[model samples]
Structures are given as C-alpha cells and as structure tokens.
Target chain A: MWDGILTGLTTAVMPFNLLMVVVGCFAGTFIGMLPGLGPISAVALMIPITYGLDPASGIILMAGVYYGAVFGGSTSSILINAPGCASTVVTAFDGYPMAQQNKAGKALALAAYSSFTGGTIGAIILLFAAPALASVSLSFQSGDYFALMLLGLTAVAAFSGKGQVIKALLMTVFGLMIATVGTDITSGTTRFTFGSVDLIDGVSFLLLAMATFALTEVVMTVMRGQHNEQEPEMDMAALGSMKLSREEVKEVAPTIGRSSVFGFIVGVLPGAGATIASFLAYGLERNLASAKEKLKFGKGALRGLAAPESANNAASTGSFVPLLTLGIPGSGTTAIMLGALIAYGIQPGPRLFMDNPDVFWSVIISMYIGNLVLLILNLPLIPYISRLLAIPRPILIPLILFFSITGVYLVSFNTFDIQMMVLITVIAIFLKLLEFPMAPMLLGFILGGIMEKNLGRALTMTDGSFSFLWDRPLTLTITLIAVFVLLFPLLSAMIGKARTRGAEVAVNEGEG
Target chain B: MSITKDHIGGLVFLCLSVAYGYYAGQIPLLPGDEYEPFNAQSLPSALAIIGGVLSIALLVTADRSVEGRLKLAGYDFWLVAKLLLLVSLFAMALPWMGFTLSTILFLVGGYWLLGVRSIKTLLVASVPFAVVLWFLLSQLLDIYLAPGRFFTLMLGV
Candidate 1:
C-alpha cells in the first residue's frame, strides 16, 4: 500500500505533472471567478480537452479545475457579494461585508488561509479514509445504492434553508421525474422522449446543468435589468497593511481544525456536498463558541467566515474521495468528471487503483500541489481578479452566453444540443421564478442515471425482492440513516413546537 | 397571475409527465430472466403519479384570494417571456451559423435586449473573442465546426 502511494507521490512530482497542477489551478481560478461559471461547468468544459492526456494527468488537470475554481469563487463572493456557486453563498454573507469595510485583503487572506488549512487537512483525511470507505462500500448491493440516493435526495429538504420545504420537495420530485426521461434500463424502453430522436438517451445531465445553473441564471440576471452597482474597490493598500493578530489566529485555529475534520467526514458521505458540510460546521462552531462570540457571527465574525470557508473547502476536497475510490460521485461536479473519465476510457471502479495506480494516486498528489499553488496565487493576486467584477454585466453576460454556446457545441457538434441547451435554460428560468431550488434538480439530473442503472442491477441481483433494501445490514443501515435524515426536519420542528408550548405553560403557572 | 394560472401550470406539467410516462412504458422489454419487474415505465409512472399529487398539493395550498393573484404581477413576467423568445431564436439559428457567428448574434441581440448601452464596446470586446474562439476551437482542438450556410456556399466547404 505504501509502495503504491509512494510511487504515486514520486510520479506526481515530475516537472510536467507539476506544470499541469499549476496550469489547472490557474485556469480554475479564472473560471471560478466568472459569474455563473463554477467548478462543475469549468470541469465539464475542459474535460474534453483532457482526453488526450494520460489518465493520471487528465485526472490531475480536472482536479485542479475542481478545487482551484472553488478557491477562485470566494474572490467574487468576498469582493462583490456575488456567489459564483451555491456553496459560496455563505461566504458572501460575511465576506463581502468585510470587503466593503476596506478589509478586502484581510478577507481574501483569511479565505485563502482557511481554505488551504481545510483543504490540506481534508486531503490528509481523504488519503487515509477514502480507501476504507470504498472497501466498505464495495460490498453494497443495489438496495444500498437506492437507499443512498434516497438519503441524497433528502438533503434538499435539510439544506433548503427555512423556505417552504414542500416547494423544495416538489422540486426534488420534479427533478426525479425529469431524471426518468430517456430509455429505461430494465425494459429497454424509452421514457418521456415524445418521439424526439435527441432524447432517446434521456435528457443530458450536461445540458440540464448548463441550462439550470448557468443559462437560467443569465436569463434571470438579464431580465432583472443590468445591475448598476459599481464594483467596490478593495483598499489594496489597506489590505496589505492590515494583519490578523496572533490572538485572533489562535481563536480561529481550533475552529478551523475542528471544522476541517467535520467537513471532511460530511463530504465523504455521498450526497452531503459542500453546502451541507459548511452549514453543519457553522452550526457546530456557533454552539461551541461563547454567547458573546456567537452574537458576533454573521456580523463579521472571523470564525463565521472561517468555519464555512474551511468546511466548504474540506468538503470539496473530501468529495473527490468517493469519486476516485468508489466510482460513485459525491457531488454534481464529480459526476460530470466521472463522465469525462469514461470518455477517456478510464473506468472508475476498484480496478482504477489496480489498473493504474499512477492515475489514482497522482491525482491525489496533484491536489496537494494545487492547493498550495492556489493559496500562493490567491494571497497576492485577489485584487487583480476582483477587477473582473467591474466588467459591465452587459459585456460579461454576452461573453458568458458565448462561452456556454460554444462549449456545448464543441463537444457534441450537434445543433440538437444547442436546441436542448436553450430549452433547458428556458425551463430552468421558469423553475427559478417559481422559487424551485435548482440544486436538487442538478443532483437529480446527475444522479438520475446512476440511480436507474443501480436500481436495475440490484433488482437483477435480488430477483425482484423489495426486501433487497434490507437484506444486508449495511444497506439496512443506510436506509435507516436515510429515514432519519428525511424525518429529521419534521422531528425537530415538532420538538421546537413542544418546547414553545411548555414555555408558555410554565409562564402561566408562575403568574398564577 | 391568477390562481388558475398556477393550477393550470401544475396541471399542464402533470399531464405532460403522465403522457411521457405512458410513452416510455411502451418500449419493448429486453429478454431477461433476472430483471426487476419494474421496467423503464415503472419509475417514470411512479414519478408521474408523484408529480400529479404534488401539483394538486401545490394547487390546494395556493392562496385563494385576489390578493394572491396580484402578487404574481410583481414577478416581471415580461423578462421571462423575452428570455424564452431569445433562447428559442438562438437555438433555431445556431445550426445554420455554426458556433461563432451564431453565438455572436445571440450575445449581441441578447445584450441589447437585456440592456447593454454601448454598441462600440460590445463589438470591440466581442470580435476578438470570436477570433480567439475560431483559433482555439477550430485550430487547436480540430473540431470541424459547420460553416455558415452562406459562407459555405461561397467558400465551397
């Protein structure tokens, strides 16, 4: 085992490998900085290019784009209050406010430092934990896979915030319904194509993703009218001059350490993703902080920003663990990447390690290098990238549209795809306007194919006994966990209501 | 803006799903002894039922009063309509123009419709982008992008 790891480490240290990591990180940062373009889109857009690369190098480049884009996303969120993706929304809550206060450099620094710390710690944990997790998951039956999908779907309810959960669940169901499009595996029958030749294979996840996340967002922003706000100039001089006190660093250090571990664990669980990991970390940190400290959160609390930043980065890093080891993607970005890997003829199961240790371990090793490069690049270069936000929305929006169209066409060379992109974008706009959450839809689109294949495979394995879900203890445990996750919100709500009623009764008794 | 529109939307989506599910259900099953009885149609049919129920739930839970209808007017329906139209046009023209010219047209018209102020800046910025795209996609990547029909006719493919 050590031999494989050491070999991977040694192979990854070559100059060409190092260059790929740097270039990947560089491109990821720029892509991440662009509005409506997150790591998922960046990776998807670049995956085709990586086809010619050796599997390890290809994976390394893609990994760079993934984590590097994440780091870059924080820049815009902190500087302009525009989150490039959903995971960075929390960062914007406090990050941009600090930037507004002329603490852009400081905010950027903290974000970078925290991201590095969290990412490195997460990588270490992933190095040790992913193999173990994969080994355990290797024994999972189809029922277990179904149970996992159920749990993943339930997260939409958990993380959809204080919004109308019925709406979120409705969207999730709608997403699952959409996922049902294309040929059904068991019957070899088509679903939902309506006689369109383009959809015999079902709605493309890539098309759906680009439409919902990227194009739909563009439409909404355009329809909302060009935002006229000038980009807040980060006081670059002030940014360089200010420093975190040793005492302040000490305070957040433990929080960062704890959140990193928490985030890594959450990320390793398929379907949890970065947003949940960050929120979970923040909730945990707030509970541990003093009352005064807690009050400071969300209102420029360093830990407020630090915890989520660390946790989200860790989660991002940890998500790759499952993708690399088990061939199961933990998030949308990784799923798209799995498609890319397949396109490159690198099958993504346990044999990935045995077939090509260089591919598996080199990609992991590149991540460590990518994070260091990103930290160094971000610490000094943030001010320059923040200028990108100043580009008029008119100019930026068009370019974005151009990129989306071109990127889509380059891969398929099919006009049918362009049509598909537009249709999906239009639908996505309507869904967004109706307050339907897009994340679950994205999750559905990515996971839908996987879910269908596994469902069929499991049924074939079990001869149609629905009890296959509970046949194995592991599958049963996953199902139970999913049940708990699904019920958690309702249970918590009931408890809160009871507590309120009890408080009122106690008050009445005291008055009497 | 009416509660009826919400109901109609839900009804339309649900009906579409059911119709889709029915069609998917019609595919011939493969010869297999060890498959789940649930075929392509099963999950989709289940989803259709789920969609139908949820739409009804949304309909029932919808606010019934006139004030509820008034709230819909505030949601900038014009913007959505324009976006839908633009996307349709882009999708239609993309095949004829290939990626570059088609994208330029879409972006230009989209930005103008969406509200960009300066044409000079738009062109200045957009042309170089077109050039770069040509070089990168056609030259470096070797993707055989379809030429514009008019251009193809003149240039002889």
Candidate 2:
C-alpha cells in the first residue's frame, strides 16, 4: 500500500499531469457553470481531449473536472439560483437567499471552505477505504461479477425517484438493447447491423455519452428558449466581505463535519450520488436543529448553506469508491469515467489495483489536488469566472454545440457518427420529455457487455445451468441483494397504496 | 382513457421490444451453438421479454394526473427542428467543405438560427474559432484532417 501511494504520488506530481489537472479544472468549471450542463456533460465533453493522453493523465484530468464541475455548480446555484446541476439544487435553497442579502462573497467563501473540508475528509477516507475494498473485491469470480452487475443495474433503477423506477428499468433495457447492436464478441457474428457498415462496430461510447449528455442538454436549453433569455447579471461590486467571522466559523464547523461523513457514506452507495447525499444531509441537519435554527434553514442560515456544500463535495469524492473497487459506478459522472477507462483499454476493477497501480493511485492523489485547486485558485477567481457567463447565449450555445459535435467527430473521423449523434440526440430529447432518467440507461449500456461476458462465463462453468447464481454463497448473497433492491420500491409502493385505500374506507365507514 | 406521457412512452417501448425480439430471433447462430448455455440471441431475447413486461407494468401503474400529460405547448419546436436540421446539414457538409469551412458554416448557421443577425458577430465568432481549432488539430496535434474530396479534386495537391 505504501509503495502504491508513493507510485501514485510520483505520477501525480509529473509536470504534464499536473498541467492536465489544472486545465481540466478550469474547463470543467466553465462548462459546469452553464445552466443545463452538469458534471456528466462537462466530463463527457472532456472525453475527446482525454483520448489523446495516457490513461493515468486522462483519468487525473477527469477527476479534476468532476470536482471543479461540482464546485462550479454550487457557484451558479448560490449566485443566480439556477443550479448548474441537480446535486447543487439544495445549495440554492439558502445560498440564493444569502446572495440576495448582499453576502454573496461571504456565502461563496463559506461554500469553498466547507467544500474544501468535505472533499479533503472524503479523500482521506477514500485513501483507506478504496484499497481495502479493492483487495476484498480481488476475490470476486465470474458468477460474483454477474451478480454485482445485476445489483448495479437494479440499484440504479430503485434509486431513480418516485414513479420513475419502471421507466428507469425500461431505459436500462433499452441501453442493453443498444449494446447488442454490434457484432457479438464471443461468436464474432453480427446481430443488429441491418446491413449498415457503421452498425457493425456498435455505438461508440463517446458518441452516446456526448449525444445523450452534452448535445442533448445544450439543445434542450435552446428548445426551452433559454438561448434568448438574458445572461445572469452578477454584480461583483455588491459582493460583500469574503471572510467568515469567528462565530460563523465555529457555528458551521460541526455541521460541515457531520455532513461530510454522512455524505461520504451515501456517496459510497452505488447509484446514490451527490444529489441525494446533499439533499439528505441538509434534511438531517435541519431535523437536528433547534426550532429557532430550523426556522432559519430556508432563509440563509450559515449551517443551511454549509451542510449541502460540504456533503455534495464529499459525496462527489465518495462516488469514486465503487468505481475504483468493484468497477461499478456509484454515480452518472463516474459511469462516464468508467466508459473512458474502458476506451483506454484499462478495465477498472479489482485487477486495476494490481494491473495499473499508477492509474489507480495517481487518480486518487489527483483528486486531493483537485479539491485543493478548487479552494486556493477557484475561490479567488469566482468574480472573473462568473464574468465568462456573460458571453451572449447565441454565441456560447453554438460554441458548446461545436465542441460536443467535434469531440466525437475527431475520434473515429466518421461522418456517420455525426449523423448518429443527431439521431441519438433526438431520441434523448424525446425521452427527457417523458421524464425518463438518462443516467440508468448510460449505466446499463456501460455495464451490459461486461455483464453479458461474466454471465456467459459463469453459465458455461455451471454447464448451462442457472444454478451458479445460487450455488456459490457469495454470488447468491449478491443476487439476493439485487433482487431485494429491485423489488423494494415496488413493495413499498404497493403498501402505500393499500394504506391509502384503508384510510379512505375507514373515513367512509365513519361518515356512514 | 386520456393518454399521458407515461402511456405514450409505454406504448412506444412495448412496440420496440416486440420488434427487438423478432430481430433477436433473426440473429443467425453457428452450427451447434444453440446447445451451449448462452449465445448472441439469449440476452437480447431476455431483454425484449423484460422490456415488454416492464412496459406493461408501467402502463398499468402510470401516473394518471393531468400534470403527467405531455405538454408540447410553449416549446420552440420549430427552432429546435431547424437547429437539428442544421446539425444534420453540417454532417453532410463535412465531407464536402472539410472541417474548418464546415465548422465556420455550422457556427454561423447556429448563431443565425438563435437570432444573432449581426454579420460581424457571426463572422467574428465562427472564423477565428474554426481556423484555430483546425490549426490545433492539423498542426499542433498532427491529426490529418482531410481537405475534403472537392478540394483534393480541384487543387490536385
């Protein structure tokens, strides 16, 4: 472990890798501040750029972008009340109120401090947690891997929010269907090419990610006529003192500490990313608060702003845990990272720890550096960075669209991919209108081929029987967990309906 | 019953699954491959059935509230359609006009579609950005971006 840490340190400190981190942070911050684009889209946009570099530097750059984007999301949420992403939506509940109170500078400072502490704490925990988990996961077999993928897919569906579980599952199915489009790697036979040469290779991960996230998100903004809306007017002169008072510091310290740990735990759970963590952490803080403090939650209580800012950053770091250890993404952003790592010919799992220690360790080390960069550099640059948001929508929109389209085109150099991107973007837009979640579909697509491979191996080992799913205790346990996760939402929904019906019947009886 | 977004989505997916299942059957297998545990058809077949079942479940338990209905009003669908068409056109133009010229035209068209009528704003935004990007790819990175078929034919270089 010590040797691994040293190896990671050496790679992370290399001048070019360090430069990549800085550039990724700046780029991610700029993209993430744009409304309708989140860390997912921001990271997706970086996929093309990363393809030109080594795996270690590419991942390091992406890690930096992930943290920067989350921080940038908080900035937009605080300043304009238009959250750059869903995770930072909780930040606006009190952050915008603080901005309105002429304490935008102070709010931004506290957010930075809390985020810095949260991310550092999460990083420290991840240092110990990732290696331990990775070592344990090294024992995982094909059956176990199949079960784990099952759990991943089902967990994503279960956590997709109210009334969206079935929709998410169907989307996951859709993703798996899309995954089967190209030649079957095992048999070397074409499946769904429909006589088109482009279909033989299946869909490119870069194209799907860029189309579904980057292009679709930007087009959605235009569809909503947001392209014509005036840019946010940030009054930098009105930003008050950027310092937190001694009392203010003491007040939020415990909240930050508590939420950081809480948020990290939630983040470590597969499919429960920063958005849920931040919301849960804020709710927990509010519930724990005294009546007077509770009353101040939505009105810009220092603790209110501190809780979510800390948790979301902490959760952002925590999401990397499953990605590094089990090769299962804990969030949509990490899912994209998983796809990128795969594109680099590096399979991220337990083997990644031994096979590519530099890639593994360097990414971990760069994450801490990323958080530090956000604090020491980004906080001071907020006023200037916010100014970039002033670029006319008509101009900015096309530039982003250009990047997203060109990002995929540069790779593969296929004109058909550009046409495919437009088609997928149209489909994505339709799905978004029906309120279907896109992340699960992406996660399913990413895990599909691996899951199929593992399942085939396990089935062959078991001599064409499904008994392997249950014969091995470890695989059985994982399979059972997957089943429970899949059914939990449905069971609860049924119970709720029954309870509602009972209440109505009792009311009718009393009235009679 | 009045249809909602959920109903439409469910119906679409159900149809998709049926078609997918039919195609899954059409995937040819190698000799004696079916005797094995799994093949190319297995996962797709399972997915199609699961997709169909889930679609049915969604239809059965869909949100029936008025708020769940698909509302198409107030959206700038015409502008969005034009923008998507422009993207398609850009793709078509790439092989003809090459990267730099196509990019410039795409940006100019996008700006215009978004209501930026100023020729100066359009030119300034598109030209330098496209040239710099092209230079970065072709010179700094040494990526061989083709000069388009027309250019190769005309210039004979």
For the second chain, the TM-scores of the candidates in order are 0.67, 0.97
DockQ of 2: 0.89
lDDT of each residue in A38-157, candidate 1, tens digit only = 887777666655755787787888888888788878877887777777677788877877876777777878888889999999988878776676566666666777777777777555
Q: lDDT of model 1 at residue A124?
A: 88
Clash tally, candidates in order = 1, 0
Query: Alpha-carbon interface RMSD of model 2?
Result: 0.7
Candidate 1 lDDT over residue span B1-157, tens digit each: 4664355446656676677557656655556622546565556666767767767766775655564342344345576576567667776776667667776777677667656758886677766777787788779977677777767767777
**Alpha-carbon lDDT, every model:** 0.73, 0.93
- Which candidate number has the best DockQ? 2
Residue A188 error, candidate 2, Å: 0.5
lDDT by residue (tens digit), candidate 2, A1-512 = 99999999999999999898888888788888888899999999999999999999999999989988988899999999989999999999999999999999999999999999999999999999999999999999999999999998999899889899999999999999999999999999999899999999999999999999999999999999899876577787888889999999999999999999999999988898999999999999999999988999999899999999999999999999999999999999999999999999999999999999999999999999988888888989988988998899999998899899889998988989999999999999999999999999999899999999998999899898999899988889999999999999999989999999999999999999
